[model samples]
Target chain A: MSFPKRIIKEAERIVSDPVPGIIAKPHEDNLRFFDVIIDGPEGSPFEGGHFKLELFLPEEYPMMAPKVRFLTKVYHPNIDKVGRICLDVLKNNWSPALQIRTVLLSIQSLLESPNPDDPLANDVAEAWKEDSSKAIATAKEWTNKYAK
Target chain B: MDSDISTGFTTDQSFDAFEDDGYDDLDTNSVVSVVAEEPLSYEVPYTSLSHEQLKQRFVSSVNQIQNLCGLSHEVAELLLIHNKFNIEWLGERYLDNPARTLQSIGLDLKYADYSFAPRLLPAPPNFLCAICCDDATYPVTFALPCGHRYCASCFKTYLRMRVSEGDIRLNCCLNSECRFPITDSVYKLLLSPSDYNRYRDQLIKLYVNCLPYLKWCIYPDCTYAVECKVNQADLDHIIPTVECNDGHKFCFGCSNEEHAPCICRLFAKWNKKCADDSETANWINVHTKGCPKCQATIEKNGGCNHMLCRKCGHEWCWVCSGPWSEHGTAYYNCSRYDEKSGQEARDQQAKSKASLERYLHYYNRYANHLESARLDKKLYLRTQKKMTDLQNSTSMTWIEVQYLANASDVLQHCRRTLMWTYAFAFYLERNNNTHIFENNQQDLELAVEKLSEMFERNTSELATKRLELLDMTSYVSTRRSLLLKDTQLGLLEGRWKYNLSN
Candidate 1:
């Protein structure tokens, strides 16, 4: 089947004007699939680290949001092990106007300010809630160990 | 005689003559209580509306809203749909703040003016579609009121996906920030004719699903909707058994087959309970008897009267569970009645046994009647043919034999009432009022069995027995009303004094 033109345009635009600290490049074999890297936001526990993620545009692209998962492990309450993030824009908040560029930026900012209140990982959130400095120390340790 | 024989032959109803069925063990005289109250009467207030009637009512209501609100039919429908199709609620909301109510449902009336141009103008030359970013020629792009243009192909794909998602509301501009909703007129001009039909169907389904009084007909493969015009306030006190135009009967309140006497709440609770653990309860009741020693339930396989409780290791006769030496298998007499077992021990045994007996009694009757009702329904077709035969063979018109149909209907009603009464009795505690209720139940049971026996007779006998069938049907109907009325009273007035543990 012919690829949807909107996806091709979004892919082209992502390559033309790359967002700072975020790199997204579509796969050579499948333009709908992309490999992305996000630089950790400064001063965050994840700072000085790089996180790899994968994004796939389903056949219902633009109408349905793309499926994204983190390939590199990170310590955060909202992002579960196996890298499933619980961000609203990735789900019901998504709209056809949202493109690869805007989505990656949202994920990058999500790393900087993690909301432990509505978290996907209970143990991580509980640890963060119990002691923030201690939890951030563990996050920093994990970032250096796995997300390097 | 051949036709009469054929009627009985074709009918699969395994009903037997009342005298032949050896149920005379039921003590009729003792069961009928001496209660001389006024005759009971109940009106199952319901009707079946034709498909055309349902449509006419909806169309008129839509038109009324359109004229009152000075909005298009689709917008009025959307407003009503958002408000759960409660037109009164819609009117009150509209009266309070019209624009806010419309805006809340994603409609901006100002955009309606943009749709005045009857036709969509094609895209300008060298125009780039915002969605696809395609350098498309004129006639290949469609634009909404917000001036957000996308290639026609892209717009169609987006609309198709959204429609399939089952939210048939109007589509908004593709741009995330644009709040302008596309008008139905614009959609019709852009979409292909077949897609347009699907879009309208989805819209109609959305309308029907949200409407407070409209429900899709429960009949399989039927697309019609059943509309009930009863006052919403009265709906709580009444169970409207609506028969859709396609001959599907369902309770308006619960969308289940008509369950009279059992209110929708109780009916739902009973269904959930039955679906949960009824089969297991039935198996235990049928196959197991409690160990006389430890009170643990025990199932007996191949064994004589002499037995031993596996848990307690107490040796006793299975029949009376007395001392092992008391059993004499000489003639299969297990044991003699022992007065030595203290009254306290005997009383506890009697109490538990009585509870089990009560449950088994209700459950068995309930299951039996349900099975009978199923068989009777199968008999209806054969009875119809038999009625025709009787009409042909005797000096009777089609109308004269139509009593057979009425008899079948009355029988079904009695069966359903009897089935639910068991569920009612299951929850009820034994009280003075329960005596009268049980008497009423017995009366209905007798009448149902008699009518069923008559129904199973040969056509010649049935023709000759029309008067008996009619009389039995009326008796069944009256007794049913009494049981249902008394059950309802017991439920409302708290006469049963429900034993929560039971």
Candidate 2:
């Protein structure tokens, strides 16, 4: 029924001193649930777009990684159509020391550099591998059409 | 009296005979000497270690590494685990350059000055545990050489979580960039007693799995591991059947049941073929014919020779598979026996049918022996009861009635060996050596069946037929070893040729 001090403190810190291009605000009813917005990094194909994501701290949070998924549609090889991001820190590489702020920063960096080789979307990865410029062009088009 | 009964049931003398006949090209005296000393020729030499015995081995290896490398116990354990308990490899690398090996395994010699053991110290003023964000909860804190300190409670939780996840390799610092390993002492200091025990069990499993020579018995709740020096490359020639401490026999090569006379490769292939739909495809190939025009598979069910393709509406004669118009006068019958095209089609059909029949021939024998072996196991259980009844009814003691139990064991063992011979024969190409192998197989099967039939007699008759049963038991066991010896020698000499591509 009650959240841990770590989750409460993390929630307080992320809101009070937010990352430059990110905003994470916990819901009033449930302190463990947060509505997140990450601004696309400059110089990336996803630039100038605001991607919405949802973060939920599981019962084993801090011991386990928080479950996060994108609410907005994004065109990236690593991000699947259903908004699952294939990032190492979100899975096996997650350390208990990593907080919500660090996880968000990792996601933002992931958007800046989409890894096609270890992609969650197979077709998108294949297209990215075959033609990079066209893949970036399509990514930009989707960002404007959907992420706006 | 006990020694008399034991000698009467022993197959050692016959095994020596097999050794002489099976390996005549080798030094027969030495081969006979070994078989006469130990009648375990068919089984690979292995030592089964219990949990405590394995732990003792682990401790001794850690001590050896520690004394050799002049490192502390915890650090030596870390090195051993990182090198997968390979003492020789670790020794070579450490002797070549200690610092490099240490750094490569993330032990960094620079941190060698810090104690690898976890120590409880008072937390610094206003210390914030980065892990749990708890600034004031715990008075004591723990930190590795990396100085990424966290509260003791938080450390306990993290280590417990990692241990429960079966991760014995714990990083020293929680900082993702730092790769220094947390020593076993730290896990012991932080984890609860039960969690620490679980961690040690997992570590032992990791050790057993890492070494190529050791494998845990695959049976459920089996804590024993068999140490065998059999080479992986020799698995094609040697079956490497080893028994655990609990008497569960299994092949050390693939961890499957003891499948002697059948190499692991062919056994696996046979299993996959039986499990897959390849046999179903064979069935379709035997029974179904494709339409000439549309290629739809057609199975004739009480139809005349003149056929019509349901999909393409093309008329054809089923017998010759030629156009119906060509069979103008021969309405229901086909007379195109010598036509080249028709003959080719017929040959293809006959080839598939033959192939299917060939597979079924071996498969039926294999399945029958497997079922019979299982039933023989049940009969052995009943023989134990029969042994007691014979002891009560006759003047014989328990040791004297042991012949029935021994006979049942030989029957089961021979039936198992007989089962795998069929699978072995299926892959064998036709050659003179194969004929010899088949003859050996027939001898073993016949001996086993006779012994099994004699074993089924009433307990009252069993006491009178004790000598007969013991003789048959010894004979059946000798027949099994002879077949195994011949197959083993044949595998080593490359005398047997296999149709492996099939």
Candidate 3:
């Protein structure tokens, strides 16, 4: 039940030099599990809201991508109801060189620019495509009601 | 007593192979005379390549590209794979703009220097491998032209994973921002011996898949490939059935079983129709009856002789389908014969029943031949034992008793062709040419049945009937080829019309 040197080093780096608007704290028992929080970017609809997410490093670690999901609900086309985020780097585009910090950064940018074209939630994507302003308004409402 | 009869016969010069070889052998004067009198227009020319032969083809193609482009072997391989092994296209593109073509596949023109031969270099003091987050000064590290340095062990693990995932073209650096391509030398240095072989096999598989003229045999565990220059447009007139080195016969066009006299289009349509109709047809036959007046399909869950159409509200008897009023006082014992209402009801039912009956008509014939062919395959296995028994009991040698085996082979082949003809005829529109096609079908079927009956006789009678069996075998094979030739000509000449509405 000991972690690899790479995982320990990555954990130390994320704690010492954290990315802006992001906070990641590992669990007391399992160094592979972390509780994360990301403040929404300034100009996006989710601005001023803090979103909670859970991240777990699988056994394959650097060879495979880490699993991350939102603990709080958000009304984005790419983020589904069960908190699965449809980001390319988290799936096929993932490379071993990519770290946990970079993945969080990609999620933050996804919030800044909600791509409705490659959406995971079909209804939200349809709504977003039909009326952009209304979709943004609904996203803001969900951010206030759920993400807080 | 040989349990390996199927494999044994396949490896020998069976009747199917005789037909495949266009009857080149003149040893059997009787069989040769039967087939050689006719022109062999139904045979498609193709070549089968074993696994080693395929590898040699791949290596020679790579060498050709290397010699033409004056590029390194690794670069030439990557270029050929990227362009789908089209040497002419690669040559044209490379001659037009070498730098652009190289850049298109993520190969920098300056890659000749350090990228081709990936070597371990001492890491800079205080260097950190970002992938594994190792801050210690690693003794040796690997870096591509992109300068994204990582420890050698990490590089090996990454390359092994990608290779196992069947990725032949790998990126030089793990960093997403760097789009440099990894060379074959890098893979050779990084991957284990087993994984490296897997990578090479995957490369050849990709090469085969990308080329339209080359197709791997569809049989399971088959390591052979067939090369045919048959055009895709010719599939309508030609059923490009090619046999692999393992004697597995399959159509090169759709990679299905060898379905001659049935073009790929109608065969595909028939296969789909059968897949959709088989279960429904069986269910309708068992549980449902159409309402006589309105023809709405009604499943009688629980009811008496009194039936009501839910849609049209037509009242009739469930037993005789006569008007319930006509059943007056009979109370389900109504025995009305040829009554006006009953006749009208039966006529209405017949009108609705015709199409289903038509489909069942063709489907029943197609399925019967398929079943008979399967049973004949079992009989073929038994024929091996019968051959051995005949050899022991009679004064025949091992070669003399092969006529029974040949007859069995012809029976199976003809039955398969007969099965597909039914599927082909089901789509054919009624015309003068269709009548001719049906006549040809009848002749082949009659000949096949005769040969099949002779093949199933007891082992003691087999030795006495050898000459007759051989003659029938040759006759049945000739009939099948004639049918195929007529159908092939009919397709090419556009003489056969199709009823595609259904």
Candidate 4:
């Protein structure tokens, strides 16, 4: 399917905005690769440090969800150490009407309140499932140590 | 023939004999006399309870009926029937009274029970009241959903404050989410005979028939005190359920919209003409409400969840769909405080504060100097006047004695002189206080005079220089008054300046 103009415009906007928790930057002057940051929301264990992720908009945008993956090595239910995201919007739950802006926003919310019931990274998912406190502390320490 | 005559028929043979004797011409008075001569009456009429005595217990349950006559005819008849069927000796009580017209029933007083209505008091008996220690006749009875009755003033104030405060979620007047508000109509029913008597003493009293207009919304979802104009026809009572708060009566209908006939028999006919025909009606069952921005068709799905753009591709949450992701579909993003912007604002404030402090310092320096110079000029004039007064001698006191020994009230003069020196010292400190250097010499001389006077021993040297400056100052002033060229006494001020080393 052909890429919608609105989708391209939205992708451009997300990159331009230096969001606090999430940083979105273009890959080598192209609209395709966006390196974004997701600071955990306040009052949560993931708060204070940036969590970097990659946003690769497909040629056929809006009609298909963006290819969002984590760049930073992290312990989370949804994201693996190799920058793979396990969100429905990025996977089988992808809808044709969804756009790049919405995809990034949903990822930010996921980082704020991670759901471990459906695991993307099995080990991290299991730890999150078994002991949520240890998982949150580890995630926060990783943010301070790596994502300065 | 004799038996027929016993019944006042005089008999058949007697009639034949009369016809033979021409008795057809007998007088009417003689006929009454013949009938009256027949002996005593035997039929005794039955009696029933008097209308007034029995009516005392009957009160119409219907509001309109009781308002018109003291008692409902239906209830009155039931009272009469009860007396006839259940109580004995009621009939004889008022057998001769005109008001005992017929029984409450239009039957012979004996059969009144068959035709009489059940005697019902206007308000149900159990709807008395739950709040008071004793019912106290419940001056302000308010019916609630649990069929419990509470003081009307108590509940009305609570609900009014709650509604006005926009506590729509607190739908129940009893402060329970499960309980619905009592209906105004049922509240009126709670207005028993004794309630009217007590209504006068309440803190917040309700007027007659005003309770219905005091309609709390019928929407179990929203029992708000709806303004009649705004509510249109959606007004309801405080309690939506029955066996009202008092647990006395149950409204047979009106629980939900599905129940077409409500328990109160109070129903509203909704005309869905506006929304029914429109394709995009907001309220699924009612009329259409268009989108605010585009005037496009709008519809609310079962939940406040889904969104579809009819025109602008603008999908949003029904709750507060105000630009979540600019053009995104999810309502997850927040209106970030953008601390970076706050940092910029704080930086601006700090910069202004630094500049303002510098400005205030400049004003403080200049303000001090201006005040000092003004006071010094006044002190210079007063010293010249004192020198002139000392020169004049009117009394016979010797000059040597005035100058030495007892001296002219030296203690008092010393005190006044010390005060003047202190004032001069204050001015000198003030003038030298500023960073500017042009006024330093005058300030130093003034300081020397002020400090030198405080030490009376060996102060002779400072005092000799002070007297020298004073004589030079007076010479300049007198010469100026004499129209002579100005003398150079300003140089003496430079010479008398204090040496910091000393």
Query: After superposing candidate 4, which stretches have Cα over 4 Å from the reference?
Result: A1-4, A15-20, B1-502
Q: Please write out the lDDT profile of model 1 over residues B272-358, one tens digit for every residue.
A: 765687556656655566777788888878757666788898777655556676554533555454545534555555666676677
Q: Where is model 2 chain B poorest over a 10-residue stretch in terms of lDDT?
A: B1-10
Reference-based lDDT, residue B274, model 4: 16
Model 3, B356-417: lDDT tens per residue? Answer: 67777888999999998779758877988997898899888765665666677778778889
Evaluated with TM-score, which candidate comes out highest?
2
Tens-digit lDDT track of model 2 for A49-140: 99999999988888889999999999899999999999999998888888899999999999999999999999999999999999999999
| Winning model by DockQ | 2
lDDT of 1 by residue, A23-122 (tens): 9999987998999999999999999999999999987777788899999998999999999989887886666778888889899999999899999999
By TM-score, the better pick of 1 and 2 is 2
lDDT of 2: 0.82
Residues B73-181, model 4: lDDT tens digits: 4323233333432222333433443145333322234432222221213334655322222334444454443444455644554444333433322133342222333
Better of 1 and 4 by DockQ: 1
Docking quality category of candidate 2 according to DockQ thresholds: medium
Q: In model 4, what is the error at residue B122, expressed in angstroms?
A: 67
Kindly indicate the candidate among 1 and 4 with the higher lDDT. 1
For every candidate structure, what is the RMSD over all alpha carbons to the true structure, in angstroms? 9.4, 5.8, 4.8, 46.9
